[model samples]
Target: MTESSKSAEAVWAAEPSTLLRVGPHFRLSDVDPAATPGFDGDEADGKRELRRTNSELADLQERLWAESRFGGERSVLLLLQAMDTAGKGGILRHVVGGVDPQGISIHAFKAPTEAEKAHDFLWRVRRELPAAGMIGVFDRSHYEDVLIHRVRGFSPPDVIERRYGMINDFESQVEQAGTSIIKVMLHISHDEQKRRLSQRLERPEKNWKYNPGDVDERMFWPDYMDAYQAAFERTSTDVASWHVVPADHKWYARVAVQRLLLQTLREIDPHWPAANYDVEFEKKRLAAS
Candidate 1:
């Protein structure tokens, strides 16, 4: 097996939670991502798991949409963060793939524009915050302020230190305003990432997805890993907890996301809007005529 595979194998064997630093002094070891019994291979297994998870996600989402129709008092936000090839795209695809497009909004944060930097870090993020009863997803999020910016020395040490508290308050306010935040860190082995990158290079259609810069970033895996550990500890809260999913086996990652989303949506449990037919009034008018 490759190093990534070994990392995953090691993770599976780690303490109850493979990722110990994910939550509030809580290890994420409690999660069991081994493919369910009778499941197929890694490739086909994900598809099968997707089938069941999508159905439940769709049903719950439909309820949220109908609830939103009448206006719910609350909403949800999901943040996806991981190293490249950690399966964020696939998680978004499989987890929210069946959700109502109208009730769900996805925002991807890329290199910032001058306008974004002109305002506070949370300024750009606040605009896309989900409305009541809606589900908003960030492919990457404001955590970059602390993660990439800190690691790359984009900001001074004092300024970087200031952001940790700022971000905590920022998320806390959103939660107080009725938007529950769910943050996920997709963890994968370095070797697996190399494999995925190589696969992209060998495939003609996937050439566009290949970025030479990604390889450069991979060189500093230790830095990014440390950055993540710090980010999760400082930012994860009772209101905005982080779920770290192993991504070396893409199937396992998908299953973890699937379960998490289903649980969150069920917690929201928005009711369907009541239909008003008014057929009785119409029939009386027709009879009189």
Candidate 2:
């Protein structure tokens, strides 16, 4: 096994509260991350869950398309966080990808650039904020203020403390502007992560995604866990809540993501756009020529 995988395996076997990858004062062991309680998605189960998840995702995408066409008033912003191999991409591909591309966008934010560091941490985030009548997704998000920043000592302790308050207010402002936030943390066993990471490294198509630095991050599981716990404690609220998604099996993660998205879209009640007869008439006329 690769060194990264081995590190994840150790964390997987450790007690849940020992790891901190997402929110404040939150521990993986405290709650059930399963979409279906008592679920087990070993190899055979993975296949079954994936099929169900795919159908659900397709259906929701259809709904989003219909809503967008109908001139809907609401917008949504979905946030996903996890350790490496947490299935963020898989969830996006299966659940939201088929939705009207014009109405949805995916932004996967990484470490700050030199320009990003010059301004307040929230500046880069504000630039990515979505407009009205659209769905925006963050593969990882500003909660990084509390998770990664705290772990790596990027910010002073007091500054980090202030950020939690700022984030809560920022989310509230977004809601007032007709955007809702839905956050998900993909929870995976360290063993499963090792397995998946190995698969990615071995596959020629996925080799480009494998990074050596990822292993270094893996070594500080305890520090990572502490950061996540603190972040979750401060940011989780009714307006912008966080959901822990068990991701040992990617299929299950996709399904949970689908369900969360469908629910959010249902809440938004996006209206489909009305048709204009002259537009179609002009199209047919051009085709005849």
Candidate 3:
């Protein structure tokens, strides 16, 4: 086994979800974005392991799709939230994108449209949910309403306060309806973010990714951290726990997310649906033809 696979097995076979889970009294400040918790591999190993695991992830995904075709209601929703240059786009492309696209649904939430804003915060979110048997990915999700809204003072204090409970309740409802949610926060350090932003500006191919607004948001880093801590405290629950992955090293982040996803799908353990037709009869019919 590769070191990356060993890293995954160590986490999976031992405590499973405990390593990355957000526990009560969890402090966001203590986490080092450059640290790869529970992983024993370097960058090269991580990339190799990701490639090795892609086939398995795809297999499990197909099984889930088959189960849904046979009337199963289980599905997965991967919710990714992060600061700019934190690699949400890379996760979508490298990790989740390894699976079959036919069985996956991806939606990236931006600022709400007038129509979306007319209703409750979750109205647009609810409409974008994946159906039974599909894997859903939200690049930036409902949490944005709380994160940006809280930091920018777009909403009143009381309004922001209430969203925590609303989000928890909404997630619980989604969980109860057979959708397993993997809520991830890709924790990137302030310096690393700056370096990445600078890289985008320096590289001709990546110049399009440079957003002036991101630099403005950096000024409110401390406030965003506070808002995230508040969100984790209020919303991370037994039904739908949050996993914070250190994302300074892009390879490690991708492997870690892929491992978490593999763990979830393994726990779900969906199998291929049994064939409905009689095998002997079909064989005899084919011979006659």
Candidate 4:
């Protein structure tokens, strides 16, 4: 295993909480996109471990679902933020797709509609929050309000500045209400992004995935990085800290995310809810029938 992968394995096996955690001191430039921080394995090993992690995640999700049916209060929300072509869809398909669909709620936020724009930025976000005992995944979340808005100058400087505190407060409120948040920023290098974008152009089947706007956005990559760095500094709070996953290696990214989810679920430690009825009476009644 590579030294980076060995380090990754240690992080996941021991203190997974600190794995890729972003803080006020976080520098986006300091992270190495090619480095695999937690798993001690090759691609094949990653795939195998991912399958195992998926099994555990699926079981935990089912238990959480059952607990919710019995009026449990806790749930989990995974908010994914990344630059284009950073493997958000892959994470969805490989990691989250393994879980029971009934226990998972996924929302892919796009440009707001006319009606949606009438309200505050978080109005739509508030509507999409997962209910008790479920796992929610946000493809692109309220962070977009800060990221895109900041990079493209869509929102005023003062308003964008205010949103940092607003987001922190909002997340704190959600945590207080029993929702554990796992926020991830999939970090990829500029060269890797170019390679992925080129593949989109070369493969006929992937042509649809290419957006002209993606190229236009690339011009502002530096600005966007600055915006993300500012966001991490302001919004990486105790309630919902950000995890910056190195995403150049798709396999490593998938495994790291799976491990992060497993760690969160482990902390939640949901159990199957106890039956509320008398087992002997129900068995006897059923036998009579």
TM-score of each: 0.83, 0.76, 0.94, 0.95
Least lDDT summed over 10 consecutive residues: which range in candidate 2? Answer: 11-20
Runs in model 1 lying further than 4 Å from the true structure: 1-21, 26-46, 275-289
For model 1, the run of ten residues with the poorest summed lDDT: 11-20
Cα error, candidate 2, residue 234 (Å): 0.8
Q: What TM-score should be assigned to candidate 3?
A: 0.94
RMSD of 4: 3.6
| Residues 166-210 of candidate 4: C-alpha lDDT, one tens digit per residue | 999999999999899999999999999999999999999999999
- Which candidate order results from sorting by TM-score in descending order? 4, 3, 1, 2
Error of 1 at 45 (Å): 5.1
Root-mean-square deviation of Cα positions for candidate 1 versus the true structure, in angstroms = 7.4
RMSD each, Å: 7.4, 9.4, 2.5, 3.6
Model 4 worst lDDT run, 10 consecutive residues: 8-17
lDDT (tens digit, per residue) of candidate 1 on 114-221:
999999988989999988878899999898888888778888878878998999999999999988787888877777888899999999999999999999889888
**Candidate 2 lDDT over residue span 152-171, tens digit each:** 88888998999999999999
